[model samples]
Target: MHLDKTPATRGLPRERPVLLAYLRWILLVTLVAVASACALSWALHHPSFESEIRVLVEPAEPRVGAAVAPDMETERQVAISGVVTAAAAQQVGVSATYLQEHASVTVPAASTVLVIQFDDTSAASAQRYAQAIADAYVDYRKGQAATLSAASMPTAATTPNYPVNGAAGLALGLIVGVGSALLRDRSDDRLRGPRDFVERTELPILATVPVRRRRWRRASLLPVLRDPSSTAGEAYRQVSGKVERAARQRRKLTTVTLFTSPSASDGVAHVAANTAIALAQSGHRVVLVECDVRVPRLAGLFDIPSGPGVARALVGRVPLNQALQASEVENLSLLPAGSPGPLGPGELFTFGAVGRLLSAIPADIDHVVVLTPPVLDAAETAVVAEHAHLLVLVAVIGATTRRDLEGAAAELSGGPSSLFGGVLLKAGRGGRAARRSQPLPAEWDDDMGPTAPEDDGVAEETPGTTAIDRRGRA
Candidate 1:
């Protein structure tokens, strides 16, 4: 009946379940990224073994006066120079360019020492090349005193540490996975909840009926008569009351309200049927019309014995009164969407029907609720909108999308129909007990038509109310 704040101020989604809808996707992405990165690192990386050999160095001749300190930095550079590398390559029977590419030199601080290091894929080759380079460097400095002191053979390569590499891969995977999830969340078109739907469409909320469970296909979800004490049932009652109030606010008498959705399976038909029942339960004379000729559900909804309905009446095969069947609910007449003739369902609704049908309905009827197909899916839905005084869009959370809502809003707003705001199919555990306690009609499957329970034609009504006849007359 009321609306939250405007869309301009809304950012984060309000519901916890809706916000976490795509959590599995994020976890999957992270897992796959981690596995792939680890696999690639293991496959593409090659280990490099390094070996080191140290040597002592001194001036070749004794100093005449004070002993000048040797320039170890300069000595370090000379050890790996072209001349020493060429000699080392000859000693190791390898090319000088190859030896130079794999060789490096360093010196200890404040000492006459040089350390020669070489790297290779083979550990033995690294050790041999390192020793050869030190021997050659000692030979190259003929005037200096140099002697090979010690050599350390490599046990393993330092380049490919599996633990470190795995940790890095994990960090990268987390970053990419979380970033992808965040970006997708911002651009996701699926409706999160009432606030998200309201934000995108900028339409007032008529009512929010709780959905205990999600269904792959449209199942039996009508709750007004199924369990009037339950949360879902009360919500439907709220929907009906708000709708009539909306019609009165527009100052319209005998208002014809159309219930629709942006896409199919949003439970628009179910909502419309329940709303009509709820209205009639509150003592309003109501006529429920199944205008969605393409996929008519109302004919089987109340187990109307497969008789003629609106489709046959529209094409003149039967009179509109014959198409109208009285439901079990008091004061409620149901006009089912009967099978179409040669004209086809699409052309039937889009071209013409509602104007003639309205003329046939009795003037005493206070509310006429027309259930129509989705706006985006069927062209006739917009055409049907042209005949109604109020339009109610049913939006199912986590199923109806933002783009579809915006599109539906554009289509309905452009028409002559008065916007009656939107109804949100809220998700919660409050209705779980109701759904379990109320038996779902086995007949209700993909068709979404649930039959009334078997009962004798008897009344347990108040003394003032009269019995409902087949023609919806007392």
Candidate 2:
């Protein structure tokens, strides 16, 4: 678990897409809402025209020796009273209830003025109602006047105002869209893309396997063997190339790479199996060892029996050769976990046992890919990590979390293993299990020597004789 010293950037370039994806959804929702509101407004909307009349009030001619004072409040109240409205409605040929609902009267502060406003569907009708109200108020005022008198007549009406503003609606929509996007980005904890993993862990990405939609009957555990010409097959080849490059950098003839994940169901088994097959197809002798004793799957993956595997050999019940089984692939062999004994995995995968197991591998084998239990779940994996020369971490794109990756790395670093790199699996749609027909590139073909002889499906053990051939042949 070698943590990269490179200052981990807060957000990598690749992670931009996650925010963008959220933004897209947010904008879509906002657009739909705005469109719906606009539609509703249009369907239920009623256009109304408004007219206003401002009239002046003055004190009546003062009596020769008597003082006369005018009260504007009283005049304003009288202008909008039921009596005036009823008279106005009768003159305008409309119901008093309608006039009361659509017309209002107010007085400008510190002035003897009454403002009468009318609203209707037609501009001419609004104007007529306003004039009628003014006339009715004046006639009533003349009858009751002792000091105050109506002075100025009503003025002409002004232009009507539109109720809805498109710019404001657009602005509100934008705000909602951006807020939703940010909220979603903040609340989501799952890793969205490769860039997020890169930024959080600062680990080199070995490969990215796309997400595949498969029919149940067509699905196979071994992608390299089942379908070799699809995108998934090509991805495995790329992983093999990376592994080979790492081996070359270390300058080791026999490289032991352990594949593990932060947790189970992260496709660690699938990656390990396919990688081994890919290396074998590249003309290298490869052995896939299943160390996940708790739940061994390599035997089922290769359709081989679980007996006489690594567990039997480790306990000295069977020799390494007796436990080794040939696979359907040309140069790959399987060493299953075999049946569990009374001892738990923690007790069985002791450092000494792992070292002995590694030392006993045939000298001619180019690569030994071991599939181990998830690091976070099994302490035994720490023991396995101590013996492995390189560690490969597999993580499902959307399923793995930053905490899981960090925890796994911390666990690996706590032991003796160094992180070689990481593999991003199930990245997006269009992933399938398949094999590629193209051969390794010339530069990457350093280990493209003669392949080991095929296994005859029988294990032989003899004194002073190696169980597996030095050239990786059974």
Task: Give the per-residue lDDT of model 2 (tens digit) for 371-401.
Answer: 8989999987888887777788888766677
**RMSD over all Cα atoms, model 1:** 8.6
lDDT of candidate 2 at residue 381, scale 0 to 100:
85
Q: TM-score of every model?
A: 0.70, 0.68
lDDT digits (tens) for residues 20-86 of candidate 1: 5556666777677777766776688778899988888775455576666678888887888888889
**Candidate 1 pairs with clashing backbones:** none
Whose TM-score is greatest here?
A: 1
